[model samples]
Target chain A: MEFKNVTVVKKANIYFDGKVVSYTVKFEDGTTKTLGCMQVGDYTFNTGAAEVMEFLSGELSVELPNQKEPLIIHSQATFEVPANSSFTLHVKSIADYCCSYAK
Target chain B: MEFKNVTVVKKANIYFDGKVVSYTVKFEDGTTKTLGCMQVGDYTFNTGAAEVMEFLSGELSVELPNQKEPLIIHSQATFEVPANSSFTLHVKSIADYCCSYAK
Candidate 1:
């Protein structure tokens, strides 16, 4: 009998903060990473490599208190599975979730 | 008001897996990541950089049902604050939290 199977993979969270600007990005293969420069607001600055293979990419919403402006996050990724195809994800968090920027 | 100020930083999670063998490591700065070659068991293989600055290092317990062997996680980190001081942390999870090695 022919059969089909499905599986889901999970990952770990690497929190980062700079108080200047930052970013965190994920991949479809479940490999998540983040990196960037924070601005005047308090935000998590995930420390990821400057370069990676081809993978999934998307945006993340960050909400912090006293944040006059929304933090812009950019994550570019590539995966080992894909021979070449790649993309980028840009998400601007509301700063509500991470309110460390509250003054 | 001549007061003291203290703050805490949080991080995000990124799930990863390989199946032959795996590992996950975290730093005091809230930077958590995982990597390794999975064996015959299943565990979350968080994809982190092969190298990091200096920071906090610790152990994690992973307990997965049907997991006969315990997964070993090693994370070595350094910090940008420190000039050079650094160390390493190795954790052996009971395979309970992220149990996917059941085959």
Candidate 2:
């Protein structure tokens, strides 16, 4: 689906030395989301706001805070990360995802 | 700058085995642009519509169609490619760019 009537940042948000990258998308209602891609690698992210990570394609296993085992995600899945927390992701392939930040 | 009141595609345009990736942004004027990132590598792109590649950051050397020598680009630069033509870029570092296609 397409995000309509929003603002898109021109520059990308690069992380893990370019292993993970995203672009900021701002909605009219003052909400924000990031469309990102993750290459095959392991990554850890610290969140300020609570986030919902929705996967569009590819494969990954995520270790969320207080979770016993990593949750495996394939194409079309969603996971939530709490605010002021951290999560680890082991990307099995090239994963494309959208992360919505809670205000 | 940000593209306001636009529509952004959720998925990314992955190229060259994730060496090059972009998100498509559509404007109200029926124009479209791709906000993209390029890792340190050489990439060749064939264009259907004419394109103007505006670099926001990083270093690269571009070989456009009909050009004898490649043009070196630093942090901020712009280059044009003809429609139905191709160009090559040798990225020295991770590069962030906005690619506008001619309507």
Candidate 3:
């Protein structure tokens, strides 16, 4: 199966100064998922299994707990829904739930 | 091709209580990434392409800029290296680099 990005996640590598930066990835969506932090050195992230469009920007914002930070990854999200599987993703946002996903 | 998850990114959801929380993901790795602000209601994130077995924990930690928190996502990262493509993901970490990746 091929992939079409549902959204894009762009990550930037800031200079030692912390204020300056370099950008990688392009964009991402709600279902898209990633691991680790998105900073200098060797950052990491990945795509979720759902498509998010109906949701607003604020809705897509994933706020970590306490003092954890959110990763800003670049590049669109793409995943080939597995073949003959029962698991599927549900599409919605933190603000307003708007879609249903199933296989 | 199938995925093997170079790393895993796990996220959690907090109750209205705030201080308390609920864990969803099992584990993550260095290449994994996330988006938005992982909190109540809905959240989003993605996976970074890279294997970090060669790195350490502190290396897997993802720190965002300003006050942006990082999403604690669960699950593994799996991407099928296209059958024939020049662009391939390099595996590494933000700490103690130890590997080279390419197709």
Candidate 4:
């Protein structure tokens, strides 16, 4: 799959000292998303806007706010997180993902 | 800087066990580029097409073919590699780069 006719930022968004990296993609409708990857590690992210994370590959376990237990994902999956909230991820392997933000 | 009116592939091009990761960006005129990053490590890459590599940030020592004493870059720089040739890199620090292909 691909995103056509969009604007892609030249620089990358480096996080966790480069363990997490993403590029910002902007659509014509004023929506923005990030194509990102996470190396095998644990990370915590605080979100400003609500987000939907779509995984393309790899295995991971996510801890969302007020969740009973961590969500274990073996393969491709999608998950949502609320705005002004935070989540944790234990990436068992290299995880490739796309994250779209709520406007 | 950014590329507008382009198509971005959703999946990442993972290389060397994810030590080097890149996203393919396609232009309207049948041109292509990759927005990529490299973690601190030694890597060798062979190119199919001639490429111009533009560095966004980082420090590294590069060994191009037929050159003595690797080129050391402390910040932003650009390097050209011939098609069907190989180059080696000793990434002293994480490097973010954009590579454009000749067509």
Residue-level lDDT of model 2, residues B29-58, one tens digit each, is 999999999989999889999999999988
Off by over 4 Å in 3: A1-31, A38-103, B5-103
lDDT of candidate 1 over B1-103, digit per residue (tens): 1001111122222322211222233333444333222112333333223333222222343333235554334433322212232222224321112211111
Error at A63, model 4, angstroms: 0.2
Per-residue lDDT tens digits for candidate 2, residues A1-103, read 8999999988899998888899999998899999999889999999999999999988889999989999998778998999999999999888899999997
- Cα lDDT of candidate 1 equals 0.27
**lDDT for each residue of candidate 4 in B8-95, tens digit (9 for 90 to 100):** 9999999988889999999999999999999899999998999999888899999998788888888699989999999998998889
Q: How would you encode candidate 1's per-residue C-alpha lDDT over A9-88 as one tens digit per residue?
A: 22222233212222223333444333222212333323123333221222343332335554334443322212232222
Residue B59's lDDT in candidate 4: 95
**DockQ values per model:** 0.03, 0.86, 0.03, 0.90
Span of ten consecutive residues with least summed lDDT in model 2 chain A:
A70-79
Q: Can you give the TM-score per candidate against the true fold?
A: 0.20, 0.97, 0.16, 0.98
State the lDDT at B5 in candidate 3.
26
Interface RMSD of each: 22.0, 0.9, 11.4, 0.5
Q: Which of the predicted structures, 2 or 3, would earn the higher TM-score when compared with the native?
A: 2
Question: What's model 3's overall lDDT?
Answer: 0.24
lDDT of each: 0.27, 0.92, 0.24, 0.94
Cα misplacement distance, residue B79 of candidate 3 (Å): 25
Candidate 4 stretches greater than 4 Å from native: none
Chain A vs. true chain A, TM-score per candidate? 0.20, 0.97, 0.17, 0.98
Residue A76 in model 2: lDDT = 80
